[model samples]
Target: FVNRNAFGHFGLSQDDFERGMNGFDMIAPEDRPRAIENSIRVMRGEKLGLNEYLALKRDGSTFPVIMHSTAKYLDGKPVGIRGIVIDITETKKLEAQLRQAHKMEAVGTLAGGIAHDFNNLLQAVQGYAELLLLKGREGDVGYRELQEISRAAKRGGELTRQLLMFSRKMESTLQPVDLNRVVEELRMLLERTIPKMIEIELRLTGNLHAVSADISQIEQVLMNLAVNARDAMPDGGKLTIETRNAIADEEVRRSQPELTPGNYVALAVADTGQGMDKTTLEHVFDPFFTTKEVGKGTGLGLAMVYGIVKNHRGYITCVSKPGEGTRFEIYLPAIAGTQATPPVDARETELRGGSETVLLVDDDDSVRALGAELLQMFGYSVISANDGESALQVYGETRGGIDLVILDLIMPGIGGTQCLERLLEMDPRVRVVVASGYSIGGQIERVAEIGARAFIHKPYDVDEMLMTVRGVLDQE
Candidate 1:
């Protein structure tokens, strides 16, 4: 189409003939090498290969150009290259973020499992200690000593429970949580727990909104903050609890990748005690890192709080300065509607057990023994089993007369859940109660979906267990 001696030619818009700046002359200095490499590859009658270079526009500005082409052969001689290209910078960024999120999820799952096992052991220690104190009687001088032992064990168990909750390994049933109702109910408990010298105040702003989160864990957050505030005020000061509504904007959302722009109910705890410096504040959420004295803290408190807030898909921020004060503000997504939840009836809590046969299954001898003793004390005949197979055997021996089965989720062979499946196969009419220390295999979800007879968590009180069992049986 053009003379062989011509130095350059344009395929379209040859208006540069007189006003003259050739296409190559306008190429960016930084992109010239990439363009030449592409030219060489195309001249060899092959694909231009993937490459990105800056193209100089007529306005003397540069823009990214991703040119794709393979050599076009004219009668066995390479002529030019041609292909399609599009910018992909945005797509690459999204892929990187997704990889990071997946990596975090893998680590969280591992932490969840470790915390679960630890909670089970804690349950055993706390449960047995409580049973021991109850067995001790009045006029016995050692009863007081035993009570102190149980109290210590209970405290240890509570710490384990907090860790498990932080790791999201504890059984949690998230209902339509009422923020106002919860705060009002916990006011008295909070007051009693904090030091008498510290003044406590509550402020409610904006209409409170419902949020979907573990109720007990929310209480845990409140309690942890209150205790921390009390400790901060060694010389005594004022502590404020406030609630309101929040709207996250783009700037805030960009700062917190896990948080997005949305409507949220904000809860805040602020103290007038000595505050934290920049260095201490930065490590506030790190586990096992604390400035407090060795005997005074576990350092898991803030870490646990962090995990819970993240698990709930909420956002948290802190503001502090040395000798001033510290404030923790949490914003949880608001749930829809103000549906009134039915109040827990006192009738369901009424204890009951008389002459009904129950098959109890647990690998731990102490737990099985204590369960049976507690059930028997309420006039129930409890046949104990060490595992799933044994439980099935015991039930079969009783000729399908098992009115209830107290099944443990974690066991050696033929565990509680599997054993229950087998027992139900033997007799579908069998009524059973499932219990677990650590949350297992979507246990809470299954309970809500499957109309479970009842569930009693480990480290439970005798009255609580009896009440749940009685309530379940009453439905039948």
Candidate 2:
């Protein structure tokens, strides 16, 4: 005789349980033998406390449960076994989420370190290539080859940027953005990229709120999702991109603990194609985790998407069933009382150089050599230092004569931040340009706040570096 609670636990009606259904039948088929053996042992006087197993439900789905049992005795003889089964599905889900979070953290650290080193190497290759191109005419023997080398280095730099994005080490320029506009801009590209057989639909709210985000990163997110959807629908299906305004109230917070109650802009991508299983869904956002066969995919697409959303102070979720298709929803906080702004196009300007004495500091040997050469070739008197301590010494000797200080943030002793503080103390009017292989993030922002004259990202573009130097020197 099953209790009403037990019947409810398995999603069973009282009449169904009364039709000769037993406890063993409620346990999953694969776990039945072991469960039966454990029960027999309990009845035969073995004190097995609590065991975990998968409990089968009325619709053939299964959930994790923990069972505790003791042998029932009457007149010194065992009559039956009494037990309790408690569902632990939610507990198991929480545990899995925690483990995934830890794994992502560890991987992110490793990715950030690798990107830093890679950027330094690429800077050397690209910098020298640009220098060579400047000296040779277009038809000169190896001019085209040098151009190709520079382009290749740029592609390598882009890969590192993606790595930095996934590791959450890259900086973003956040602005008020409308999801509907983003979708519209990419509509033609998406249509051309995705197969002709697949149908595309856009369901945009007439008055969706604006989100504070990086427009380029949002475009990347949308493109990645679209490509993923196309791959899932090899036989052709419908892909829907939807944008809507939403509110994360108390009820919503119960499901997503990471979100605070506020207005949000929701962008959802849904596909009618083959879907993912529970196991695949769990690791979908993990770096280098891929379902595609070797050489078909890089596996960083979803991982980068995950990082971009998180970096923007947003959240994302995925839902899918084996053959029922998939859906991805991204929620970014709404910027109330704001309108989406179009990005301004930067006008092309002629690269110019100035006759100013510049002090260049970098620990990397190749980078230091290349930077000193580049600056001198551009008509600036260059002074070089391998570390922050040496940089301070050089600056002290040159004192007022040095017109600009190009300082590298990461150094062996007296790192960038400390060195910057010391330099400020020495001369409040000192002009310094902070340069690094890393993107403009927290540390860079802090340096700017502390009176950094300008900032430049490494793997230096000759024109950009020259332009930045010229721009800063032109300032009072």
Candidate 3:
């Protein structure tokens, strides 16, 4: 007879118990055949060490469990069977989390490697494009062509950024953010960006708790989802953005492997469009998996959303049917007593130049050369180092003359992070502008925490590079 605890584990009450309710009744329908086959082996005096399966509870929910069964023989022949059933729901969740983390890490390593090489190539293309632009007026021959090249290179840079974000390689500056405010702000944009045929609705909860996340990345997630929703409803349909405070109880947490038991803020994007089938939904968050025709999609939207949510320590899930519309719910952990800062306007800032000495450190010779040239053009005397060792040597020799160090993050010999540590040791006041082909996520954030003055992503334009240099140098 199953004990109270065992029955409770299956969400069954003792009053409903009956001998007719065999183990098969508790086993998931899809797994019943396998469970019976294993049990028969146990009955035959075979040692079934351990077996894993999905067991169905009284509420029609399924959970993972590990069972070990052995024959209870009275004589030489086996009479019956006894077993121990251990609940492995939490274990299964942890294992799933670990597997997802490992997968992201492996993919991130590959993305970082490719981005580094691609950024080097773009640097040369963009550098020449800018140089050509300076020689000719906007309407002059090859001037517009140069501008187009620069634009294309910038687009390529964005593609790499999306890839890095999908792999969770991009470093993010996390801060407390109000979910309601994000939705409200996005609604204004959605109203103009989406087609007139598509109706937008905002269902923001009042006094919603704040979540810890990057404001820009969170906006990116919302915009991607909104664009996806618009595309889904070609004929026009209703799109809804909703937010609310949420709490995950133990029972609820078991069903969502990515979520732990805690308070959370839920943001749901729903669309009354042609929803995805199970097959499409399964691969929706996979990079480069798109249902659109060629030239219509790159399929990085959902994948980037997944990576961003994971980096924010949040959980996201999609609900859809073939035609019942679709909804994506993202739950981010919430904290009390925190207020969100309004996002700064994205208008261009006035470019400035400074007369200071700069030590440019980069593993890539092309990037270093281009960076040094650009710095000199901005009125700064520039020195170059191809590696961290040489950069440190230069820093030690011209300690007072070097106003700032623009250090590349991924270099041969000592890595950019290690170099930062050594630099801080040598001069705690060393102002470093950490630069990389990669996004300002993982490694970049680490360096920032260790006292780096600023950050700039690779393939930076003349204006961007100059402004960052001027900004860091001008910092007192």
Candidate 4:
């Protein structure tokens, strides 16, 4: 006689059980044998405690459950089995989420380290190549080869930047941004790049709320999703990009525990294409995980997107099913009573040369040589040091002669921050420019607060570096 609660657990009515259905029938086919074995053991007075298995419901769906049973006897002979079933589907989900979080943390650490080291090496290669190019005419022997070397290094630097972004090591300049405007501006570019067969559609909502985000990073996210969608629909399909404002209240929080109660700007990219199955969706955001051919994809696209969203304190969810298409939704916190700022032009005008004395500090020998050579070539008197201690010593001896200090942020001894503070202590009026292979982020902000005159990112562009140096020296 199944109890009312048991009937509910099995998704059945009393009448159905009255027709002779039994608990054993609810055990999934693959686990039926183990269920029978456990039951027999319990009936024989073997205290096996609680046993776990997949329980099947009437609708052909399955859920994890733990069964606790004891033998029911009549006159000292076992007559039946009595048990309680407890559903554990939510528990399983929580476990999976915890595992994924831990895995991502480990991968992020590794990625950040690799990007830092790689950027330093690229700096040496690219800097020397640029310096070589400056010495020869456009069509001179080895000029083209030097250009190729420079271009390749630039490409390598871009990849490292992606890695840094994915690892949340890169700095983002956040400001109020309108998602609608971003999508509209990208529409023509998407049309030009995506296959002609695929139709593009925008469903932007009017008067959408503004979100505080890095415009460039947001653009990267959109481009990555659009590319993924284009790839998903090889036979041609409709790709829709939508933007709207949303409020995440109690109900929304219940479904997505990661989100706090607040207003948000929702941006979604959907494609009517071959979608992902459950297994594929599970690992979709993992770095180096891809469904495309080896030469066709790098698999870092979605991983970078995931990192960008998280870094912006946003949430992203992907929904898909085999042959049913896919949709990626990103929710960024809304900024009330603020207008979106237009993106500014970051192009440099000219390579300015300076005649002032500059002190260069870096731990990498190749990087140090390249920086010193570049500065000297550009008409700047250069004093070089291998680390922070040496930089401080050199600055102390020539504090009156030095016009500017170019300090590397990361080094073996007395890193950039400490060195900057020490320099300030020695002479409050000293001019210092902080440089790093890492992107601008918290460290940059800290140094800026501690009195860094300016910043230059590594795998340095000759023009940017020189302009920064000259600008800092010329500043009153």
lDDT of 3 by residue, 181-271 (tens): 8778778888899999999989999888888889999999999999999988999999999999999987768767668888999999999
Model 4 lDDT at residue 430 = 93
Against the unseen true structure, what C-alpha lDDT does each candidate score? 0.72, 0.89, 0.84, 0.89
**Candidate 1 or 4, higher lDDT?**
4
Candidate numbers, best lDDT first, in rank order: 4, 2, 3, 1
lDDT of 2 by residue, 103-222 (tens): 887888788889899999999899999999988888999999999999999988877877788888877778898889989989999999999999999999988899999999999999
lDDT of 1 by residue, 1-476 (tens): 22322222112234554467544544578887767777787787655467776656545666555666677678988766554444444445445546644654555466566655655665556666666666768667777776776677667666666666555566665667777677777889988998889998889774667888777788888888888899899988999999987777776665555667787888999999899998898667666678899888988888778767876878778889998999999889987676535335345445567788888888877778878887887789988889889888888889757788888877889666667677777887777788875674466567444444778877656677888788766674
- Look at candidate 3 and tell me the lDDT of residue 44: 79
Model 3, residue pairs in steric clash: 170-441, 171-440, 171-441, 171-442
Judging by lDDT, tell me the better candidate of 3 and 4: 4
Displacement of the residue 127 alpha carbon in candidate 4, Å: 1.4
Q: Write the per-residue lDDT of candidate 4 for residues 1-476, one digit (tens) a residue.
A: 77788778778987876888788888899999999999998888999998999999999999999989999999999999988889988778767877986887688778878999999899989999999998888989999999999999998898888888888888777899998998999899999989999999999999999999999899999999999999999999999999999999987876566788999999999999999999999998888899999788877899899889988988888999999999999999999889999878887667788789988988888998999899889898998999999999999998789989999998888899999999999999999999886743578879989999998988899988988888888788
TM-score leader: 4
CA shift of 133, model 3, Å? 1.5
Of 1 and 3, the candidate ranking higher by lDDT:
3
What candidate 3 gets wrong by more than 4 Å, as runs, is: 1-44, 49-101, 346-348, 424-429, 439-442
